[model samples]
Target: MHIAFVSLETVHHRDTETNRRLRTICELLRDAGHDVHVFCAPHWGGDHPQFEQDGITYHAIAESTDARSGVAFRLPIALARAKPDVIHVTATPPGQVAPAAVGAMLARTPLVLEWYGDGGVFPHRWRRWAAGRADRLHVPSELVATWIREQGLSGDSIETVPNPIDLERIRSVDPGEEVDVVYARRLDEGANLESLFLGLAELRRKDWTATVIGDGPEREAYEQLASDLRIRDRITFRGECSREERIAVYRGAHVFAQTAEHCVFPTEMCWALASGCVGIVEYHVDSSAHELVEGLDRGFRTTSEAELADAIVEAGDLERLDYDETFAEYDRSEILDRYLVQYRTLQDEQGLL
Candidate 1:
């Protein structure tokens, strides 16, 4: 099977969850003996129009000087050249949906659009038209699939495929006991790190240490807040760690704290839980973390900062958490097999099987 992935940004340019997932999917498909190709805009040092790496082909549709223009102008040519059996495009806000849709039509291939964010009906005419053009819509969660259906997408058009995680890699080592709590997320306004700082300040009355893993625009402000609360000494901000470093931090922490006001099935929290850390999520109206942690003994959903502090304290008392049963469905191999089934089904429907 020949599968071509169309996206605006390359994983080499941005270290985002969607880009990472795209790369993972390509790798999985390639490993399954499928010919997988990624069509994306060029990134830094990626001057070639086409290159092969890690058993997959990468075709640059446009240079970084003007990626949007490149997508509109060059994507169809690239798609025609690749002549993929099925076209899989990933859509985020500001994605190249229109261009990808056009390319798929030009190639006369079955199109699959993967929505990478919280599902909501797109109100814009172009976006709606682009989404409607797809032969199938793949979403990451049931919540998103339901929301898309509420927006009038037919049940047959939408499929809920949860994000994939490398469970073996996440569970490779035993958790350390050096850090009492760990918070991992971009320190942006939506992350609500201020609440975590306040809650940690409250936890200072007890003996606890925390390490913040990640970096963003709010780093300085969060550090200052930690200082103002006089809990700076007990916290360390290790910004934007490598994958190995992040896994180490998760292993070293006894508890993982999520204070984000908005989230869509966070991968880091899953990694933390799978890495043997107890999970605590501060509840918010827009957050989907509760969906993952609710009803699990090792996980707690807190409605208030006070509750978060208390949950952290309670988590510190737990000796171990068995996340295998809860996270079994998220295994990378299982998710890859699901995607393969979807691809083969599309191929069979199109008489390409």
Candidate 2:
């Protein structure tokens, strides 16, 4: 299958969660023997498509929305060039869907959409209508699937494809005697990271260390909060890293604690599990956490900091949540197989399988 994945904001845009997932999924599809191409508006503040990286092909094109009208301006040409068997879209912004809708129509390709987050954030009808028209919809967690249906759509349109991990990248890390808690996500508006710092402040008194492995807008605020909490020495804000660095951090950490309550898929937590850490999740709701806990059953969900703190305390005793079981589903071969299946299914639906 020739698959074209379209997204204006890609992981390269900022190395955020959704982009990371998009990269992993596209890689998996390519590894499975399907021809896959990625399309994004290069975040380098330029226009036109960027070509293949390593073996993966990318087309970074002209894009402007309320901020950039170039989104529609870029797609039709890219679609004509790609001539994909299936066009998959990620994160459908209200005004942006028309570009996707137009591009897919012009290319005469059926569309598959992987909605990255809940519509509650968007709160608009244009997105809803566009979502309904897609050939198939993917949600990374059941919680997200539920929310999609709650918005008056058919559950038949969606399938759950959890965020994938680079099993090989994680397998290289040798777990030693390191005892640190790891939190790896962007520190942006949606991430309520300040609370995690305060919660860790309470834990530092117990001879535990915390590892933060990402950068975001609140870097200054979070660093200041750490200093104010007097846990600065104990907290290491290892800024954006190559995939290798992240696996190293996860291997050395004993627990993975994420307090963000709004993610459709708290990808770092899944990576930590793949890295063999005991997962401690503080999701706003249990949807994503339940999916995280499916393997080793290591995830703990709480709505309050006190509860999150209590979870941390419990996590201290969890000697080993053998990640192999949690990560088994994401084994390189298995992930590739799943995509092969999705590709074939889509092709069969188009009489091209």
Candidate 3:
């Protein structure tokens, strides 16, 4: 199968969740012996109109990275000429979806839109138009799928395909030194580390230590909050550790707390849960973190600091595990199979099978 991925900005231009997810899907397609090509503004060196890297080919639709309108103008022709079996486009610049749809129609190919719902602010009309244009929409979580439905798209057109986790790596890596509780994420204003800090502060009399596993502008503020709570010495700040490092910490920790103010999907919390840490997520109006713990016995969802602290303490009663098989459904192979299934379904609907 030939798959064409349309995104004005590639991961080479800037690293973003939407770009990374598109790249991952394209690379996975390439690895599975499918012909994959990425159409985007030039992110490669030299004057080449096309560049092949890793297993996939990237076609430069515009010379400048900032030339979104130029890219949009050229994409329809480029995509039609590429003549892929299916066209997968990112909704980063929602304006480009209409052009990509034109190309797909011209090429008589299925058009699938990847909308993570985390892409920076765009007009609601643009999102609604993009949702309406694509034959199918791929979202990372049910939360995002709901958002798409709110855009007036039918639930039938939206599919929830989650982010893939490397289960093999989680199995192979050894656990790092243990901590009673762990919280990991960029410590930005939206981090909401205060929820966990207050929860921990409530347990000052208890004999438990915690670890914070990320860094950002708000790290100092978070640390100072811990100090002011008088539990600074009990909390270790290991900012921005590698994947393995994080997995090890998760393996060692008994509970993983997620309190972010906003999240399309609680990816870090998912990782921690897969590593055997009992998940404790705080509910936020804008966050979908609690979705991971809804029906699971190994996790808890809390609505306040008191509930979070109680959940953390209750999590101690569960057996400590180094790894859990429940999340194996989210492994790379499983996710890749899901994508292939979606692609085949789209092809069948188009009578191209």
Q: Give the per-residue lDDT digits (tens) of candidate 1, residues 18-132.
A: 7777887888888879998888766536466778888888777766524456577788777877788989987753446777788887887888988766434575565677888
Give the alpha carbon lDDT tens digit for every residue of 1-353 in model 2.
78888877666765655677778888877776777787766554345446666567777654532415576677767786678888888754455565676777788777777776744534656567668787788778888888788878888868787767767767676554475688887787766777778777777768877878788898888889899999988888888987777777777777888777677776777777787788776656633765676545566766677777778888877776424555778566776676557766867876754
Better of 1 and 2 by lDDT: 1
Weakest 10 consecutive residues of candidate 3 by summed lDDT: 120-129
Model 1 TM-score relative to the real fold: 0.86
Candidate number achieving the greatest TM-score relative to the actual structure: 3
* lDDT tens per residue, model 3, 93-135: 7767777888898899999989887874335465567668788
Top lDDT: which candidate number? 3
lDDT of 1: 0.79
Q: lDDT for each of the candidates?
A: 0.79, 0.72, 0.86
Candidates in order: C-alpha RMSD to true structure: 3.0, 3.9, 1.5
- Off-target runs (Cα >4 Å) in candidate 2 are 8-16, 38-53, 56-83, 95-109, 118-126, 201-205, 227-230, 294-296, 321-323
In candidate 1, list every pair of residues with a backbone clash.
Answer: none
